[model samples]
Target: MAGTDAAPADSATTGPVDRAAWVALAGCLLGLFMQMLDTTIVNIALPDLTTDLRASTSEQLLVLSVYTLAFACTLLTAATLGGRLGRRRVFVTAILAFTVSSLLCGVSQGPVELIVFRGAQGVSAALMSAQTLALIAALFPKARHGLVFGIYGAVAGLAAMLGPVVGGVLVTSDVLGWGWRTIFFVNFPLGVIACGLAWRRLPQLREQPPPRLDLRGMALSTAGLFFLLYPLAVGREQGWPPRLWVMMGASAVLLVLFVVLERRLLARGGAPLLRMDLFGSRRFTVGLSLSLLFFSVFAAFFFTVSISAQFGLGYSPLRTGLLALPFAVGGVLGSVLSPGVVDRIGSARTLCAGALVLGAGLAWVGLTLQPISGTMSIPAVIAPLVVGGIGTGLFVAPLQTAILSDTSEANIGSASGCVPTVQQIGASIGLAVVSLFFFGQVATQAHSAVPATRAELVADLQNTAVEPLFRAPMADRFADCARNQLTSAHPDRPAPGCDGDPSAQSGMAADLIGKANGQLQEAGRAVAARSFVGAFQTTLWALAAMCAAIAVLTLALGSRPGPNKPE
Candidate 1:
């Protein structure tokens, strides 16, 4: 409706959005929302899951990494499969798979179960996401594609913003006594509705005749990506140059073999797994690199902000999610305006501006984080975050245009898959790198701050801690109890008195006071804030460096007016 007049000169032949087309778009949009939602929705619940599952920090990180890795690796194959078969068939199958996976994830009892289900969800997401752009292309005429894409951009940007909030709300609500399980469970109903809508509304475009599945290519690429990504994802947690390094080396070898296999496939006149020639186009190559960089930074934003709001500022998940609303508003504002900017200034200049603006926003955040207090002034955080959000919106859509502008229509699905696969991989890398950097920095800072031994530190913690130890078993055994009834764990279990006599009455009294005083003195408050803020600033600095580098590459991207501009 927004850009109806921009429809192709011949678009009227198919008429307007029409009952079927409109319905189909809505259905697809819902599916898209679900997939994108899973990407960020797990952030707020990570700490909760760590406690409930008795998971180590590294194990918790796996719950996030495996999903992205599976999603990224399968994307290219999924897109090609959709194009060779039918978008409708793939879409429907993916939705069902994703729904069942969500149910499985909700019921998971351990880290393995959760990781496996998350992988399943990622595979389904790959199938679903690849066809979205391709189907949208067929739904509208060429002239109207730009406007449709803008709508798509707005939907994606908005979904990402809402994910953390929705995750936060569900986690905070503890509905049906579900606790963190509610976050994954909420998707069950949403997924079912999406499936039903898609079945009824999506146009079953004449199914294309099936082509060869490129089995060899698929296997090689899948293995190669697994090798490359598995190490990257798990390395930071497992320690680099250890077992991760072995996997990293193996992945490099396999990726090299994959490249050789692709060459052979091309020589044999077969369709390669990835269109290797995509790199031949300067615009495609440059645009893709920038997209990866931009998303890498954007992904970091969600993780950092969520942690800062919850662990540092002591906000609940819902409140933290609410804090991110301005990001979505800014994102929408920037996305809507990007088309016009590209029309007038061209994609290159627009991207350059986005890069510089994003840098400035991150710089503002880095500098101001020092002064951020527990009172949590929404305006202070929102304004600069909004500026960064706007920068994100401005940079993404135009990059897509530049990448696809010269691609053959037949290969558009592959092109679309490339966009998201690169994004997910970049996101995985960003998270791993940032997490390692943060932990490394915190460990370093913590050690440097005091010469106390671990026992001494623990003793100091026992005597002067200020906050409740959420990690202790007593806290966990009673985790099912209501928050109001949640009593201090260690205090309930009496320790030896100062004179070495164990007595419940006097020991309990002294223990309670000590517990309160210790909780009050615990570095949970100061250390959490200092470590998080320090890591956040460092990560931002890294992102700024990445942004500037990508900006340089963006200049090499061919000059294009983008789809929205009149020829």
Candidate 2:
């Protein structure tokens, strides 16, 4: 059922040099753009989805996590199917699936429906992702691959940057009453066009003799990834109950079984979807580790910063999205320099330098968060982000190249899918883990600092525990409190007779009313500021640890893979 049994349909490899190649490239790039953009686009739109769908915080997390889970699980199979069924066929099918699913996502009436549709989109994404690099490799001659890859990297960086912008514009706009749905609905035309172009222009290479699909391995991997991801995604929201523990246990068992299954498949002369032999190459292994760690760092950064910008700093989604532009700018600079740095300084050194810069950026972000608030200066925050952007730009392409360097050209699809899959898994884990740290910090701080006598403290704790629910209102309150409390020189000072409750003083004295209200508000604001600062500091420390670990792993990347050398 799995392997390609016959040569690819024998179409001429080269046709008249015309607009065909150009069309093909554009289509592929469009497909790539949609795929990558979807990964982050939903992030900015979560607030809208929550309001429309009446979804809980946990449900929104499922919406994001499920897509990633499905993508990660199916990637290996998708890669194999591309080779066996014909890359163009698989590519078109994927685009159509993604397009249709996206439409479903937009039309969905509830969280469950939206999540299901998103999962379908993820499946479509996996299929398309499997073939992109292979298609690119087939389209360009060997000598031109470096340039092709460079262009591809740039496209990816652009898509990532554009996601927030697209989401922000769509959500802020009133046209068609689109709101968040515009983000999903917009993909329809692009996907259809890409599918059409791919069907017509893609070259047909002779397929090799049929290879076998490892169904057992596929099942094991899927089950294992789901198991691992489910807990990471949902545990924080649900407070890691015993039932969740069972799922986590199951994931561990299944993963071990998956590894064992893969080994057995390799021993049986079956082309195990993943060549276990690849890991023997130290560079490839290290590269993968760095990929996982680096992506985890980025995931934590984006998640934390997104929440902080809106929640801590009280910025609009549009403004926050605009503020994030510097990361992309940095990425562009990094991409521009990747080739030169790789050629001159060597890929390893360039990557390490990027990591160091990223570490510094994170350290700056951590150190600079102020208890006082005047909308954290745009340039001050962007400075660190630019560092991260440049570092990521340096790291992504070369790291990928190094990881895949040792992979047999035949299994390049596998390596391509594998690397991104690992990165996404790291991302999902980081999001979940960091959320746990963030909310946990909030809860812990609330418990320790908030007073037992204040009924409001209970609400605050619950709010902190489920703070992800406070899309805007609670965040605004928190920010207002911090701003007023930090800047106010005499928050608790009463106006003349302000000491007594306004209700008690109502019949007796008008002047006491204002004073009493002011005193209570001041007290409340002080409590909130302390709690907010505690949560803020705690989350920063957690992010710092994650980033620092990534920095260490980045330092471990020994060297770049020689061109065409297996990692």
Best by TM-score: 1
Query: What's the TM for model 1?
Result: 0.82
Worst 10-residue lDDT window, candidate 2:
1-10
The deviation in Å at residue 301 for candidate 1 is: 2.4
Which residue runs does candidate 2 get wrong by more than 4 Å? 1-23, 203-207, 372-375, 443-556, 560-567
**Candidate 1 weakest ten by summed lDDT:** 483-492
The local lDDT score (0 to 100) that residue 263 gets in candidate 1 is 75
The residue ranges of model 1 lying beyond 4 angstroms of the native Cα positions read 1-19, 56-58, 200-209, 312-314, 371-378, 444-523, 562-567
Expressed as tens digits, the lDDT of each residue in 1-567 for candidate 1 is 221212223332444656666677777888888888899888778878878888766678779887888898999888878766667778888998998999899899998889899999999999999888766766666656656666776677778888888888888889988888987888788788877777745534322445577788788778878877888776754556666777678778887887787777767767776767777788788877877777777777776777666765567778888877777777777787888887887878778877777777777676666522223356666787788778767876566666666666555666778888887877777776666665555444434222222223344544444244622422222222211111111111112332112243365544644454343224334434554455566667777777787777778875654445632
**What lDDT would each prediction earn against the true structure?**
0.69, 0.68
TM-scores of all candidate predictions against the true structure: 0.82, 0.80
Q: Write the per-residue lDDT of candidate 2 for residues 59-109, one digit (tens) a residue.
A: 887887788888878887788777777777788889999999999999999
